[model samples]
Target chain A: DAGITQSPRYKITETGRQVTLMCHQTWSHSYMFWYRQDLGHGLRLIYYSAAADITDKGEVSDGYVVSRSKTENFPLTLESATRSQTSVYFCASTITRYTGELFFGEGSRLTVL
Target chain B: AQTVTQSQPEMSVQEAETVTLSCTYDTSESDYYLFWYKQPPSRQMILVIRQEAYKQQNATENRFSVNFQKAAKSFSLKISDSQLGDAAMYFCACMNYGGSQGNLIFGKGTKLSVKP
Candidate 1:
């Protein structure tokens, strides 16, 4: 498909276990972002990648790690997942830096027990 | 720092009626971008409408429109003739064009419920 796609639409993991959420886009956008959607917190950016190897932290990036080895894939990893990490994760991409509406994928819901 | 605030956590309107969702933000920059995104039960983030800070005219799309008050830092969405399909979590987001790469700072969403 031409749009972004997320893997494992639903997931359940145990605390202290490692889990990775995958995001891939067909547009080859230079900017890719990972955000977590909680009940009251809305969507908080976890990590963002400017290019293939350049990544930056967002407001709530404490418990997450991200890597962008290629332009199409930006994967978020939890070194040691916690119950608080149980939320919906979304991946978005945009072609322009300061302009353009973001294209998002169907979110991945992760529940940490 | 730029922060978006949605004062209404939830709102309900009967079908065929109209409703408005209020959003306020704080920022120092004069020019930026504002957006309203919809998240449905399917959980896909959809861009409902957008407004540019420099534009004097409000942005509207079909039944969705934004009453953007730049001086007051207010951006509200008004859904006319609301329908069941409009039931979703609507988020107000802001992105500063000052050295940022389209990273949206979103407010706590306002859940819209359309009742029969």
Candidate 2:
């Protein structure tokens, strides 16, 4: 794809199982982010990476883990998936840290069983 | 911490008419940004329009426009000549430069429905 893409658009996993959502961007942007969308909360940032090997935590980064080994890849891992973790996950990228406009992927719908 | 709030959970507009989605935010910092995002049935977040806090002029893009009131912390989106394609979940988000840069705090969102 020419733009950002998320793998496993639809995922279902059991409780206590480990699952990872993948994000890849072709724009070679400097910043990448992961956000979870729920009914009442809208979209909350989980984790973000400023550049390769540089990452930071957002508002809801308690149970989530993220890494940016490469500029084009930023993956979010749920060590122990729970029912509450079932939500639509979106990966976004921007050229600048603060002022740049964001570009989001289609989103990965994860269902916890 | 900055917080964005979209009071309206849903809004409906007749085709060819105009509709406005309201959004309010709370922040201590003076410098920041406001944005409106659209997520259709496909679940893809698309940037509708953006308004900078420092700019006094409202931002307009085609049929979309924003009324940014910095003093009241209100940023409302107005869509003119509404069409069926405009039906989607519209989200209001705020990014604070005082803290993290790329991190965005979003409101609950308003689902806009266009009736033909």
Candidate 3:
């Protein structure tokens, strides 16, 4: 239980509603990421944070927003959820981007109707 | 742009047999790394194996091994003596160490099934 953990393992929301997926890691990793897993697209990075107060967009980041006010936590928010945004979200953390593999949380699945 | 491609969407194999999953990538960075991750039904992402581009030798871990062909821009995962637990979605990913942020480009997964 010392590794990364996600909140609301499963969620259901309506379109135009707001949803936030929470991610926290005990490792205090400098780098954290949010990725969405779809059927044909595999896993696409939504957003990433290099450190506290520093976040950047990824390949599919238009509908997602993230903030890393703390090194251990990175929460992704969908301001206006859509049907296409329904997917499994994974939170990952790593000590350094140069080496080592990322540690992922047990994913959070979201459904929008 | 960097990209990873997994041609096979699904594959089946007999228990105790061997199966290979193919992956190809396009990247401009000479020094990078490739990884194979297994996503079981539990939906946890587990690292299977990793290979560095500069290293000529492939990487292996127990029953899992990778055939990394840097020249051909191909990396394949081979699972020997497959078991029932090996049935899951396998993904191939690439990361450029020299690039910015070390963001990983992942390929579409291959769902592997082990038939008894």
Q: Tens-digit lDDT track for model 3 on A1-113? A: 67999988999999999999999999989999999999999999999898999999998999888988889999999999999999999999988999748889999999999
Q: What is the full ranking by DockQ, best candidate first?
A: 3, 1, 2
Residue by residue across A43-84, what tens digits does model 1's lDDT show?
999999889999999989998999999999999999999999
lDDT of 1 by residue, B74-99 (tens): 99999999999999999999988755
Interface RMSD of each: 1.4, 1.7, 1.1
- Cα TM-score of candidate 2: 0.97
lDDT against the true structure, per candidate, is 0.93, 0.92, 0.94
- Fnat for model 3 comes to 0.63
True contacts kept of each: 0.72, 0.72, 0.63
What's the lDDT for candidate 3?
0.94
Name the better of 2 and 3 by lDDT: 3
On the 0 to 100 scale, the lDDT of residue B34 in model 3 is: 97
List ranges where model 2 is wrong by over 4 Å.
none
Q: Model 1, A89: alpha-carbon shift in Å?
A: 0.5
Residue-level error in angstroms, candidate 3, position B33? 0.2
Q: List the residue pairs that clash in candidate 3.
A: none
